[model samples]
Target: MSIDAIIMGIAFICIHLFANDLLPSGRIQRLKWFSFSGGLAVSYVFVYVLPTLHKEQITVKKYSDYLTMESELYFVGLIGLLIFYGIQKVVRKAQKEGENKKARTLFWMQILFFGLYNALVSYTVISHEVLGIQAVFYGLAVGMHFTAVAHDLWREYEDIYNRVGRYVLAAGILMGWIFGVNVSLPPVTETIIFAFISGAMILNVLKYELPPDEEAHFPTFAIGVISYTSITMSLKFFFQW
Candidate 1:
């Protein structure tokens, strides 16, 4: 297919996937603002430029706008798509397989990671304007948790092994900088520490004896909330101005 078609296709799929995650359980909802924003951001380019191509109706200004729109669509859409697929695949697999003992362990582990990931993203977005050089610290914090988990599980999930491995490596580097003797901890350090500890404590719930159905409700809500808030903020940032 043409590059334009490929971009539009990916953008559509990603926007749909992310928007679906935000839907209320068992309800069908139309596209959210983020999805529309992403759709326009992606499809508008081809809508505007492709018609003008063979008719000798194209202009440089039109081409420039198309390129700009295409770039943003691809970039933001790619990120949203990755997060959507990552969460969807894991959750679906757990659901289909009926959540065996090990699967349950891994499932809750993923939830713990999800919580930490949310807090990390929240911090990064909030501090982006103020932290300047310190933003890397937030990244490092996220990386470290990702690394520890990935390194421990890479052998099982070979498909994402490389991605997980890379996160682990970055996490190590970030941890070194954060805790290194010379570099003092930043202001967010205390809060992040508490969050990490809380995540760990919450994760221990996985160890307790419980039926699969009984354990599912809590995490379903947790993930749903995370999905809603993340998509909401992303919508505001990308479209609402």
Candidate 2:
């Protein structure tokens, strides 16, 4: 792995481990301006991630014999979204049930899925296809994603998150980097993984960004989305990254 990839992996681990500290708490947590982070993350999805997924589609087209449908990758994305959405539903239900065993079951299920997602995203970041600075920026986009996710899990099951969830996710960061460095999968497989991860990311960003009606700040969110979109667009045009 390059130094940048190593740096990113370690940073990601720290994000999982220390997200509650990194983010604001109590009343500040519910404020609308906080949605700015979600806005920045959503901006990346539209401008950078979706286009990258389009490019990955070509690779999937070139290599696959059976999965030849033009929209198959997109279907994978949809599947990813649905999978995480189901997890969220389960978490919500478990919370309402207020049963220790059921919630514990859901918590394990949640972390396992998120752990795999974390690993795959980290794995993709260090791919040869993403290059140096691009990898760093991609890592940053995913890092914002990780921050939101980590905070959400931390909030939902604070004790379990502190005890087990963060460690599993932290290991996922290391696992992804290890796999990325040691193993090289076919381009098509990597593309599919990226697509799924992107879809899940979309749901997570929207989930956190939309919050409740009383908490969401449209003007603040819009400003974040517009400004970041402009910045990313400018960078893409100027640098072709």
Candidate 3:
């Protein structure tokens, strides 16, 4: 095994061990351990071991190939950290006695975000980038995955477990792709799809414009305009030579 593979294994073990301690010590929670171990094992195989074996099997290979996998795994691990920490914070907050309603709402919001993101991933992988603004679309897709996973976990733990899962999945996808997997299309297009779906859902759920005015019919048009302008500027800069 390469240094990267060893590093990934250590990282996964550390993260899962830390996660085991992070949750409250109540309900028959063997499932939590089971899930964490299972996920870690699967991730190890697909993201690390298999890819390493694939390259080793090849007759000729470039050093860049190995480096690319290393870089991707590094970022993927970082993404997992982001997801794990975010969920941990939320879970701690939700456990507080007075924050029940707020906790539930936040959890649901996360689910909605994941739902939209994963849907976008499914869509983009099938539909190649037509407009060419890949970042926006992929960002949106990731956002939706956050929503979907959050929703699933909300239904199960009502504790934002989905948020953690979404982060891991997104990180996995990002890193896996960076190394040479074709499981996903470009990120920009995914983000764009997420943007559209999330924008629509926000108004319906919030029952008013974003920035949340009291008036039910208040216009969030300005916010939308500014956001669009910013995206456009970013695309121009990114695509510019």
lDDT of 1 at 192: 35
Q: TM-score for all predictions?
A: 0.25, 0.92, 0.30
Error of 2 at 155 (Å): 1.1
Which TM-score value belongs to model 3?
A: 0.30
State how far residue 174 of model 3 sits from its true place (Å): 20
Query: Which portions of model 1 show Cα errors greater than 4 Å?
Result: 1-73, 128-241
Q: lDDT tens digits, residues 1-241, model 1?
A: 2333223223322322232233334422221322222222222122221222222222222534444332332333345335534653675587578776655556545544543443343332332232322233223223222322332343344434343433433343333323332344453343333333333322322221111342234343344335544543464467542
How badly does each model clash, as a count of residue pairs? 1, 0, 36
Better of 1 and 3 by lDDT: 3
Identify the leading candidate in terms of TM-score: 2
lDDT of 2 at 93: 88
Expressed as tens digits, the lDDT of each residue in 1-241 for candidate 2 is: 6788888888999999987787665665546546777777888889987888888787777786887667888889999999999988987887888887888788888999899988988898787546566666667677777887888888788888999999999998889889999999988888888889888988888777555667767777788789888877887788887
Cα displacement (angstroms), candidate 3, residue 48, comes to 6.1
Across 1-241, the per-residue lDDT of candidate 3 in tens digits comes to 2333333333433332243344445543433323332333223233323343343333123423454342443333345335534654584487575587776666655554443433443343334332334444333323322332333354445334534644543444344333322455344333334334333333222221122233112123333334444554476478751
